[model samples]
Target: MSTPLSLDRIQHAPKALLHDHLDGGLRPATVLELADQFGYDDLPATELDALTEFFRTAAHSGSLERYLEPFAHTVGVMQTAEALHRVAYECVEDLAADNVVYAEIRFAPELHIDGGLSLDEVVDAVLAGFVDGERAAAGTGRAITVRCLVTAMRHAARSREIAELAIRFRDRGVVGFDIAGAEAGYPPTRHLDAFEYMRGNNARFTIHAGEAFGLPSIHEAIAFCGADRLGHGVRIVDDITVDEDGTAKLGRLASILRDKRIPLEMCPTSNVQTGAAASIAEHPFDKLARLRFRVTVNTDNRLISDTSMSQEMARLVEAFGYGWSDLERFTINAMKSAFIPFPERLAIIDDVIKPRYAVLVG
Candidate 1:
């Protein structure tokens, strides 16, 4: 018998996450304690409820720029290595408990340097946390493997430098490099050298595109920067049109994306909160999935969006009436698109994901 497609049940199915942010998933109490410990008293709220509401409110302002405003506090408290380690460890614990077996959590190393640590020190601290988190989660019988995707803020000029940093630690928990920030003016093409550097080093990367911006951003990320994957490529829907009979037509760009099988890291909750999609009901995930686009579900910022992998899948089930098989397909899509080596990705898929999902998708 098949398991019901409920949120609680969904947590038992192994999942792979690719687009989550490290700083954005901090627990409210962690933020508060870190702030108090570090003498950074600029938080807008002292209590948990008020702080949680503050983040949710900022995220729901329907503006990408505004949605990112709450990160100042989380990143502010995370300057020291101890804070980064704590945040990274907790992020794994939360994801592991949510049944995320494999995750590539991302953060900007440059942002943490404001606390007086070097960029290398920042990366080392986070990696150490991930190693410890993996061990602890395994001890708890969850068995999660967490990797890092060092991010370069799109508005900054350190893209090349950060790309190099990702390469230096590629053997460690760091598997990939990424560029993220407000997408209004800072297009991915601005960081061509960084992407080129990754490519030159035979590294993989995904670009933040088609989220707040449009196809132009997507175009540059793919065509110019050679992004291995797209971060929130939801806006590719702009190039598509559906007929009255439900037949969908794909534009050239969309056709290329589909034909190339480039992964679209679609974060539904974060997309809605950031106005990338008007609401969950109107998200293009269903249409894109039906069209055979390499669409994968993700939680861009779990704490900010108040979401988890289970919550993301459950919301899809609620909105589009998806079933367990649908969730399995999305999970497999993420694993297939993971930046890990082909053998490693396949091992997890065949051993962990397929077997666990076989029971849920019975």
Candidate 2:
């Protein structure tokens, strides 16, 4: 067997990420600084280390609702355009440090309106930050590309507006649309109008389904709303039956998901933290990868999960004995599944991803 890749090696490997949250992944020090700058005094901790520990501990509550509680502080500080730009800029710098060559970070533009910034202003500020970050990374000899997915909170009533906003800024670094929030009470079908609007405009979108809920949620996201991808579709494992001798059976939904090549944005650590799965070892990523499903690894919430793409890859390597080739496959799957145009995706794969991985293998 080949040697297991070290954390340093993993950090140096080229990677692609599809399912990361902007507000959910802020640096603890940034959170504290932004909070102080904005005069928001409801933080759970004062110092940076304690604030970091508080977020990590709070996210381990095994309840999705509780897992999302820390966002209030992050969002509280992100009301101004400057705060949004700084957060977006630092997100790129952090991802570049971890060697994520391509990433699509998602955030709700509607969430930053409390300080009187328009949705357009919010999108422009974040886009400017991405442009600046990419240029800075290039100067440092790291060619990282970043984009945005404008998200709408599912429990709210602004999905259609968010979808239109996403379409309005598609060429300006906003590549897709999404809806994310508590999944128990507010279903994906509630935003059918928004999905239809995106489809009508030929825009790409992914839905947060099969997480904190069950099969029906996945079914609606696919069958009814026509999701381009399933965010945390890990719960689709419920439809698969593994026999004693390792025979596998796929139910109708699972079969359809596999047959259609729908991407599953599997975030293993975040899944375990949210009680979506028992543990990292028990995550459906292994089974789904074995099944030849379009599975991609992700750090759903870097801060809350206390993870990076390298960290996620290392955990999978330890759990399933995955090798460098396996990591390459996941990276390729993510690139293919990105919401960018076909030719750009091909260029990234052929020019950036393949060459980088070949050097690593050599």
Candidate 3:
């Protein structure tokens, strides 16, 4: 029999990422150059290696709020359309190199207005970048399709407007809308009008829930705010109790997530860094996967966590002793949960994911 999958082998597997953040995955060199060119002078370190180490360590603060401090630098550099396009293009290049065949990248448009670009202008530049990135990657024989999810900060009051922006860009490379921020005081329901508008327009969205907060946040995301998916809904495990004999009892909320097949976008490395999961080994990923909760693996922020889809999958395989069958299942789960149209999702599954895994699973 073949040996356990190595990181190199995992890199060759076709992967789909549903929960990566655009601003959170900037290259260190790119960040430095942009900051210098755009005149944003808030970098903790001037050197690339130092700045990379800064982000790597800052994310390990073990508090979700504290872990987010490094973003100010990334967001500071990404104030202009040119910077946004370059970042977006490099993001695709990096993901394509990681063998991600499909991805849905989310960014808050309001965060980029400090550079004087309108909301639509922000979305347009990003969409154009995606087009060029895809074409360039195709030339290198690493064809990838990327979609955008316009995110609104939950603590802010512009969600209704951001939702409008998301829908406006639906026909152009954008797929869905999302609300993300510190999940404690700012609940998903705080933006009820935005969710309602999304539903009324038949738009799709995911809500950041159950990561920094608990089941209450998840419940509101589902019951009231109508989230199509839960971003970092790792705390849904709270609703499940396991005994010494390995008997698990599911609470009502856990049952709903599993029974309804709601996808939990689980990011293990980032989760550990943010104090979401205690550690990679203690992560509820195996428990929830065994319980059939429709959990999919992700690299929530590549730069902060120093992770890629392949690296995330490698960690899970080592931690859980999962084989190719398990990895294939997780990849399929993510592709299925993607916000793309049904036919497109199925095509990637049939054409790319299953074919690649078939050789490994053998």
Candidate 4:
């Protein structure tokens, strides 16, 4: 039996996000306003709706370069403290409206330093925005909490610096560290020193791997770098062998990943957009979820992919015929894999997530 999870139901369902990008999920109008304020005339579209369509199209072009093109404009305009705060605040507002009870948004601090703000200043501004956003959500009778992840671009040479920065801000609203950017030419191993620093300092981190590349990236992220969670680990599917009769065999790496219970932060729509997965139905999310490999759903970029947590869940339901139980399980998995303290994670699951789902499933 299947429970029909309509759009309204999906929107009201409690959700947890583990892999969202701050620069990639801007509001179109906000982008335009910031660009105008910053005097950035490089935007492809001046009109709001046209800009939205342009982003959606570029992201869906099935080329990674095209998919990342929109971030140039978003990040270009977000170089100031006020712009960063506004973007971060609006992110919380948007997620709360979609019933995201908890989220961890990641952005590279090195990219926003062009506006003459120190790395510390960038983080401070973003955290302040999150705090304000949470209070504002409370005023609206909604509950939402957000954490930031300081990211370093893999293709760049600032991983070590960013790692130390993440450790410095660990006590603040910054929850973890990460390395993002192109994965093919520049491997995660290039940032091994950063990962080791995080491990030595007892800090947590997630690595972008196996989305555009293959199992090698996944292997390094787990075996080499010790990623607490994987950003778009969908390509781990390549190691699995499935027969026409439905029998499945797991390869060595796949076996290790399953046995170790490494969380796979899979973003279905973003995967499709980057050609990481051919389509949502063909996505390995169902296989990974069935195997119980600590899989969690995420929206890699809301504005670029034109998705939200609710939309992601709704698409999964339509593609894989999932129900309320499946949705609840995904939410719980994400909550469990959060970078927050253990007691706090438990509190959210027991006190907030589970209860909210129970009411919906009832």
Candidate 5:
């Protein structure tokens, strides 16, 4: 067996994150500070240590409702423009510290309306935060670029409005649209009008499918809704079959995914936490990687999963016996799958991510 790779070494490697949630990754201290500013005492814990404990407990419940509970607190404190800007700025700072070179942070703008700010105002605040964060990181000789993905609540009825909001801010900072929230009862097909509109405008989009649901959801998102990428498409494993001699047979769906080159944003720890996979040891990331599927690693919710890109890569290294080459492949997959313009993506691959990895493996 190969010697296990050191997590600390991987921590310094360049990384990209595509599936993180804004509401799901607030710093505990920031949450407490924001809560105090708003005069809200509904927090389960007042102190930072206790607050961290509360969040850990809430996330480990493995129930979707419990996992969503912390968002209420985070969102409650993020109603005002100032609060939103602070949180978004801090998110970028944290990602830079973790050595992430590029990230696409997503949030549902509709969730931040308690202070009567319009949807545009909320997005503008977050965009301003990213701008500030980029400047701040540059001061420390490290830089990170952030793009916003406006998400629509799947169970809600504002997808069309949210899609339009994404298109409106496309030139500013918003790069793409997504549909988030509970995936069981709320199908992606419900937002067909929004997807159609985005398509008409030549906008890009990714759909959260096959995470909590199954292959049917993925099929609808791609075929019916025209998703450019598949978020947590892990459940597509259900479409595969194992032969008697340990050979794997690609089902029709798996073959299609491979042939079409659709990227799978696989979040290992979060998938395990959400019961989407049996365990990290049994995750299909290795299988998909071996099968040449376009797979990328991500931290779906850093706070909820208690993960960073470094930690996720460390786990994959341990679980799948992956080497630095595998890590490079994952980064290339993310760069290829990103919703950014072709020139920007090419610059990242050639000038930033690839050069960093080349030095690492030298």
Candidate 6:
């Protein structure tokens, strides 16, 4: 194999992001603009630079609840349809600029209901924004597809309702369903009705598990809830045991994951920011990859984690000595796990993602 490629070039490489929070990835300038337009005076800082620093500090505090405060600011300004459109448009533009070929951005529609918009209306606004974004990016000669993953806040009792909303928008732009928020108190089984409904409809869904919680959460999400993929399933590392002679024995749970081909949407920076992992060096990504688990890299929250797909890939390269082939594998893993239809997913891999990566590593 050739010498490992540099991180900077990875920024130009095509990437697939299967896990990212729509509200968590807003631009700071957009937040300021929306806050100003709505006369919402709750901003911790008024100046752009200060506001950026405020978000960074909050996310770096290593508290999940504190890290989520910026969303309150972003969501506060996104009540109006126009504001939601702008944020969604900008999100696509930013990701396209970062060379993300395909991304599944997720958020809870119920959160935007506080702005006096119904769940369907909120979905329409975001979908309209995505259409505008795709058109704009096409003019710039960049192809980026943004799919929505309707998230139901786990603590709230709206999972089944949100699942129906996701199905409603399936033909329009929404791709899948997800359960997000505090993982400890709100187990995936709590929203069993929604998962069952999605399963019956043959719809795709993922669950946020093993991030702030442990293996049981992941277990319930997969075994009980039938998660098509796992969101931040980093805690599966807890089930791995290493012997003095370097022999690794995966626990029964880990074995099931490997055997069943469950994809782990591992976000290194976000894991560190949320205290899921002690540090990037200690992240289980390398171990998981080595064990041949269906591992894919992602920027869970681009704004809060201060990460892009390239940055996440670069970190893995440096930390685990990954090369071009490894990066290619990661991208393929994401493509395989995407909730899109089989033909469309294959088209993206064959016609777009693979061709781009071929030139990079050739």
Candidate achieving the largest lDDT: 2
Q: Write the per-residue lDDT of candidate 1 for residues 257-281, one digit (tens) a residue.
A: 9999999999999999888898899
User: Model 1 segments beyond 4 Å from truth?
Assistant: 1-4
Off by over 4 Å in 3: none
Q: Would you list the clashing residue pairs of candidate 6?
A: none
Give me the runs in candidate 2 sitting further than 4 Å from their true place.
none
Relative to the unseen true structure, what is the Cα RMSD of model 1?
1.2
Instruction: Work out the TM-score per prediction.
Output: 0.98, 0.99, 0.99, 0.98, 0.98, 0.98
**Which pairs of residues collide in candidate 5?**
none
Tens-digit lDDT track for model 5 on 85-188? Answer: 99899999999999999999999999999789999999999999999998999899888989999999999999999999999999999999999888888899
Where does candidate 6 stray beyond 4 Å? 1-4
**Which residue pairs of candidate 1 clash?**
none
Per-residue lDDT of candidate 4, residues 202-309 (tens digit)? 989999999889999999999999999999898999999999999889999999998988898999999999999999999999999998889999999999999999
How far in Å is the alpha carbon of 158 misplaced in model 3? 0.4
Q: Write the per-residue lDDT of candidate 3 for residues 1-362, one digit (tens) a residue.
A: 25888999889999999999999999999999999998988899999889988988987988999988889989999989999999999999999999999999999999999989999999999988888999999999998999999999988999999999988888998899999989999988889999999999898999999999999999999989888899999999889999999999999988988888999899999999999988999999999999998999999999988999999999998898888889899999999999999999999999998988897676
Query: In model 3, where is the ten-residue run with the lowest total lDDT?
Result: 1-10
lDDT of 3 at 273: 91
For candidate 2, write residues 268-310 as lDDT tens digits.
9999999999988988899999999999999999998999999
Query: Weakest 10 consecutive residues, lDDT, candidate 6?
Result: 61-70
Model 5, position 360, has a per-residue lDDT of 80
Clashing pairs in 4: none
